[model samples]
Target: MSDAPHSGVRFRGVIDLDEHKVHDRPTIYVYEAPVRAWHWTNALAITVLAVTGYFIGSPPPALAGEASAHFLFGYIRFIHFAAAYILAVGFLVRIYWGFVGNSHSRQIFYLPVWERTWWAGVVHEALWYLFLRKEPKKYVGHNPLAQTAMFFMFTLFTLFMIITGFALYSEGAGIDSWQAKLFGWVFNLFPNSMTVHTLHHYGMWVIIIFAMLHIYAAIREDIMSRQTMISTMISGERQFRDDRED
Candidate 1:
């Protein structure tokens, strides 16, 4: 017997016709345009910040005697600050999109608030990834996992950048700097300002890890499901599956 359906004839084939028809293919949609642009731009800014930040954090011993070479450090700091500003702007744009954008782009959908449905969604998403489940449940906006990770990471980076940034800027102040006073409470909470600074420095590694995993997961989904996971962010169109089977 053939697997393909024939006119009014049920084939006693070993394979299930329903399974073949049901698991036909996967679909996705483009749900975020501004988000896509912001993603790449933020990536660029972070790269600049990481490179300049390293140089600023540790000066080379070779340049110890050359005062003129200090100019390089100055320029690096300037570039870092500039990139920080750009990143900040990107964050603000994302926040706005969360409200005014499509249902898929809405922040509330992704940011769970102890609801049963949300928790269930989280579990479903996890199982989908573990290969225990074949298809991911559809959501108009950010999936629960993506939402949670993005929220946590964005908050961490924003606060870290602001606090460490002000601290570094206050290095020139001799007790008269407003930045120092503003961050004094935070400084006192840590072992020392250097500890806070170091934490902020190391936090980049966390961001790097997140980035790697995120890209890998997206690519994997795109390949397995034929969904344009990455492109949807740029094109704002998603190929949604009309029907899904668990």
Candidate 2:
């Protein structure tokens, strides 16, 4: 029998029709191990960076003991730096994976604005989120609107953060250090370190907002959409509610 018209349910001709049973639909491996690894690692790094970066900007109450005995702010800076390095390395590895991984892997790097159909999909997804559409289209990878946000919002801002982050680091690394030589140009635009520091602080908040939205969207799609979302990242498998043609 043909798959049931409704999603997340399938037909199986059996002796008992009264009992409803949901059959497993078609599934495909989407995310690779490297992609999943980078996702979690990047998430952790962003978390640490955001939290400690905030404290670095506005430190907590001073400790009672001597400055030598209290390394509270120092330790916070250390964690922020460590997390920044992890984020930078993970970003590089993720870029490499995009080149070698499956076609779905590079979905976030750019848009398919040339294609009329892709634009159509983007509009459809936007309306779906706005409750203007009844259903969301199923895709093995990210939908068009999501790709746009991931590319423009997440990826672009991530690159910005790395650049500014390194430039700020070059301050401590000294003028002769490699970081200073490479990223010191960032200082050229804003000679005052405070200006860059303010921008960097705001960048952290932007990323934090993106993270919250990303998580909310993932969970929402996982529940409301036809395909798996959260589990797909963990297991690299995307299971559709129905075996409908895409």
Error of 1 at 195 (Å): 1.1
Which lDDT tens digits does candidate 2 get at residues 154-242?
99899989999999999998999999998999989999989999999888988998898899999999999988999999999998887
Per-prediction CA RMSD (Å)? 7.6, 3.7
Best by lDDT: 2
N/CA/C clash count, model 1: 12
Q: What ranges in model 1 sit over 4 Å off?
A: 1-33, 58-66, 103-110, 172-184
Candidate 2 differs from the real structure by a C-alpha RMSD in angstroms, to one decimal, of 3.7
- Candidate lDDT values, in order: 0.68, 0.90
- Model 1 agreement with the true structure over 1-246: per-residue lDDT tens digits: 112333454446757466444322334554566877877898898888778877777855555666865676677888988897788777778779978876655663246576888788778878887888767766656677666776677556665676776676666554478867876566667746788778778876666766787788778766664245766766766664344333
Give me the displacement of residue 160 in model 2, in angstroms.
Answer: 0.4
Give the best candidate by TM-score.
2
